[model samples]
Target: MKLLLTSGGITNNSIYNELVDMLDKPITDSNVLCIPTAMYGHPWVGPGVKAWKFISGKEENPMVNLGWKSVGVLELTALPTIDKDRWVPLVQEIDVLLVSGGDALYLSYWMKQSGLAELLPSLKAVYIGMSAGSMVMAPTVGEYFIGWTPPDDSDEALGLVEFSIFPHLNHESLPGNTLKAAEKWAASLKGPGYAMDDQTAIKVIDDTAEVISEGYWKLFQT
Candidate 1:
């Protein structure tokens, strides 16, 4: 799977161009499915209009609004009750998976339960993750970003990527997301990590990973 891990969504031209390059086609010709299940588990972003805004492309983050040929919602919470054959083909046919930001563990839990995690390795679609969505690809989110707890009460995630992420670094709204705090967060990690602002994104194709940024980012190695 191709991975476009972002702190915020496609907030700048660099990130946008990277996504287009990954797709290898015009945005207007692509099919996209957005996973909004993560929002419901977050206290500040959940179970309300925020989810609607994200799906409808009214949210500030540019995911579903990217002028795709078709856009659909893949609600992880509802997958367990449905037949796999019904949705699996749709997932396989899509060009991209737009994962929204919220609670990382919660998204991880549902992704596992919904059987999406198992299929991730072989999927051909590009996986675009925003904030917690991106963090879920890491081995663990660390205690600092833990919000909703899973059944085992662990910070463990999908482990698709080697390093962890500390998002929204130095953003005005999130005062605690300063570089100092990010440094402390990086210290608690077992492997390497990145502290990136909204304007930065990490693009991973196979084993190669590259940083595409318009603002700033720091890589902290343990």
Candidate 2:
């Protein structure tokens, strides 16, 4: 039940140190598995590689350069046709599961359809979610009403936490990702929610959640 849900990847020392501490071993000794399946929801460009690049074309992926002994990407969409036995072993060996951000609904779709939601709880690794990745771990995604599509028609989540996470708050690059917009979205939800900017993260261990950040964030309750 160790989870480091972040608005973005390890952006500063606070988050980097937190992750190092969570690993309990030297950073270089860890094995990380990156999942970019959420990117599937975005508009397809050309080939499969191009579509992947479209979602992750930014600078270096944080997980790959996090000093882990090895980093691998698991395209969860391929799970439907691949043998579970193979992927399950790969999942078990990782020290961390780094979930990338894109469309939250798309990520949840594969997680549910591929049985990842159920399998994650049993894994001993730390779960690190960024943006859309962070949002899907909540009891519900709530109504985003932003660039990404709201969680499917049902608007549910993996139920990993009691409340929802509204990430990328006040992020200048993402239009409409302001505090006012976040508050409006949070108010629409039936339960509690947290609005986090790029420098903030919510670390959840079992039922407890601690805010770790060097920047701004807000917690809203009904």
Clashes of each: 0, 0
Model 1 over residues 67-124: C-alpha lDDT tens digits?
9999999999999999999999999888999999999999999999999999998999
The local lDDT score (0 to 100) that residue 40 gets in candidate 2 is 64
lDDT of each: 0.93, 0.79
| The candidate that achieves the highest TM-score relative to the unseen native structure | 1
Q: Estimate each model's TM-score.
A: 0.98, 0.90
**Cα-based lDDT at residue 222, candidate 1:** 95
Model 1 stretches astray by more than 4 angstroms: none
Q: How accurate is candidate 2 locally (lDDT)?
A: 0.79
Measured with C-alpha atoms, the lDDT of residue 200 in candidate 2 is 91
Lowest summed lDDT over 10 consecutive residues: which window, candidate 1?
142-151
| Root-mean-square deviation of Cα positions for candidate 2 versus the true structure, in angstroms | 2.7
